[model samples]
Target: MMYQLGKRIESIVLPVEMLQQLKPSDFPNQWEYEAWQRRNLKILEAGLLLHPLLPLDKTDTAAQQLRQIIRGALEKPLETGKNNKTMQALRSIALSLACRTFDGSVSETSHWADGFPLNLRIYQMLLEACFDVNDETSVIEEVDEVLELVKKTWVVLGMNQMLHDLCFLWILFNRYVVTGQVESDLLFAANNLLMEVEKDAKAMTDPDYSKIISSTLGTILGWAEKRLLAYHNYFHSDNTETMECVVSMAVLSAKIMVEDISHEYHRTRKEIDLARERVDNYIRSSLRVAFVQASFQYFSIMSLHRMSSTR
Candidate 1:
């Protein structure tokens, strides 16, 4: 229906109407219908009320009314028959909220479920389609096709190329980590995406974008640094490939975060020095940890040997 309507939904009505138009007979039982109904209603509440693109007006009676309807329906399924009065009231108020615009007039695109973290979560889930479900570590060969199809929803998702890159970077890095870090390719690909994010960070000055980027890169940097600073433990000669990727990612994330996050940031010929200094710190820290571990092992063996001699 959205495509039939030229994809100009611009409101929560799209999902809400679809729910309302369903007949109870469409489900296996009344209980099933009610459960499905409640779940969707929570989605609407999450998308429309909890994390709306526009800051909700606490004084808006219509918003309150919408909440009441959701809250009530969560407890008891609301009648959603085509002629139901409750559905009529919900449709009216939800449409009103969704039609709001920055210039004080409505647009053909609405942002009900497209708020910051929510949008990121949804987009990341979509990007997960690129990974094979049967083997979670393996990216599907059809990833390019899946991504192209996923990009079609960017308008409704309020995603731009920069946001997509950032989200995809996180997905790659996280999937790599979660899958026992065996897919060096995923880590390698994530470092590549981090470079794109670095470019975007340098180009964009929008605070909203910066905030999200900063938070995300901070996480990536912290995780990357943890491993890099303990490379003696985290990486072996066999996995030097992983070490290379982690170092590159850590340096890039720190560079981007430092440059974009600091208002007083000044650029110098320090780019080369940044990597040098970071790698130096990682080496020193890792050597210290390695030394401590070796000493502890040496003392433990010595104690065991002394006990055997005495025995």
Candidate 2:
């Protein structure tokens, strides 16, 4: 009886579109709803069942571990203000999260090919199909190719929450960034991709994706100001002081470009230049200290890796 009940639970948790087809009225009894919930609970508990060798708990831990790896990767250039530290950190976090969710393991060596690549390809295909870009015959052929790829990949990887989020990010990036390209078809395709992602986002109940998307959008918007002033303000209060200093310097450079030398271009140019230069000098001094801290972090990781190998 328990086995039969469990089987019934497993059968009902289909795609939302499929679930919508069957009404509670069709179930006729409370037992059916209870069985549905039980199956969902079981599926949720299993967590990336394709990689059974890696237990869900391990996968969860791996996600947390990858965050540390990303921090290490970004810390160096960030400290020296050689790159956009906060933006680099955000990308690292996104990539780390995707790796954990898709690969079902955390290691120094992991890439989108592990699982995310295939998932993203299918997502892009689906977005294209919705627009009927090709002729009727070509559309059918393309969809078949996409479906076959999805089938083979899923057989190897199984579905996971991380793949879903990666797809969302790909769609978002394609829509907002890639769409700015000069190509008309590409821009249209990007619009279609974002619409699909927005639909998927609405379906998800998790708060993490929401938080990351909101923060990422804010970061991108701040990047558009031509000066890094907005970026500095956003990351200043966070532990990313190195990134803040870099952005402050960038903002100072931008101020210099707009003011001081361009007296005929603007009235406040000289005043802004003097103030910005002072701030820039202060940040540069602080950055030297940050570089030392970043160097220590890098060496410590290398030392730990060496010790582990010896054991």
Candidate 3:
């Protein structure tokens, strides 16, 4: 019965029409809006809370509710002058996971999918809930649980690239939050996942699915570039370090393309050429940004030195 329910929820992809209707006008006020989101959060929390007692179907219903809540939350804007960034992060993370589910890869989801559904399902839910309910120690405990789940389930889920990519993204988010850094380990994992997806890009029969996968990879790359720039800001005094890190990241990306995604694997010669050109352009743009930042820092330092010497 639970397996049937899991299958049913798995089949329940939220339609575009329903998504279009989940706008802010649907709610009367901020409190009620938050209440609706919290209710969805509770549904997710309850499913994980009662996972051992309930069947997988009920558990999946919780996952489905979480997915719906993410979609609804995204359509509506948050109230002004409130520190709801955590809530916003929850919506983004859950939406990424939701995207994975509906990308058609979940149809043949393996038993490995069942290994820790609750842990994976309630990640962002638990994190946002912690902001409301927990103290420092409790928040740390929740982070540990999510990280452990991420580490354990990561390799197995690579069998499904969509799942693997989003799951890796969740791991990257948590790592950044907990340690204030995106570890090289996480970046390498993401690199491998993107390469794996690209390797099969020519073989994917569904054009929509292939496009979605490519879009997701692009999003990951965007996130990475943003992180690099953010890290550089903090180390503006060390231009060498900034240049090396940013250039190394771009090079790592180019190296992955060269070594893994061969021309023969591409659907056509034109496609492979376009892919190579895109990576080259990305590297050049990244270096240009880095050079501009470095120039600004150098000029700032020189101005400060001149002022001090004049004084």
Model 3, global lDDT: 0.45
The clash count for each model shown is: 0, 1, 0
Stretches of model 1 off by over 4 angstroms after superposition? 3-12, 270-272
Better of 2 and 3 by lDDT: 3
User: What residue pairs clash in candidate 1, if any at all?
Assistant: none
| Ranking of candidates on lDDT, top first | 1, 3, 2
Candidate 3: lDDT of 30? Answer: 63
Q: What is the TM-score ranking, best to worst?
A: 1, 3, 2
User: How do the predictions measure up, each by TM-score?
Assistant: 0.92, 0.25, 0.36
Better of 1 and 3 by lDDT: 1
Per-model C-alpha lDDT, please? 0.83, 0.41, 0.45
lDDT of 3 by residue, 203-257 (tens): 5555434444444444445555564544434335735443344444444444434
Judging by lDDT against the true structure, name the best candidate: 1
Residue ranges of candidate 2 with Cα displaced over 4 Å: 1-144, 158-180, 211-311
Q: Tell me the tens digit of each residue's lDDT in model 1 across 117-165.
A: 6778888999999999899899999999999999977877788999999
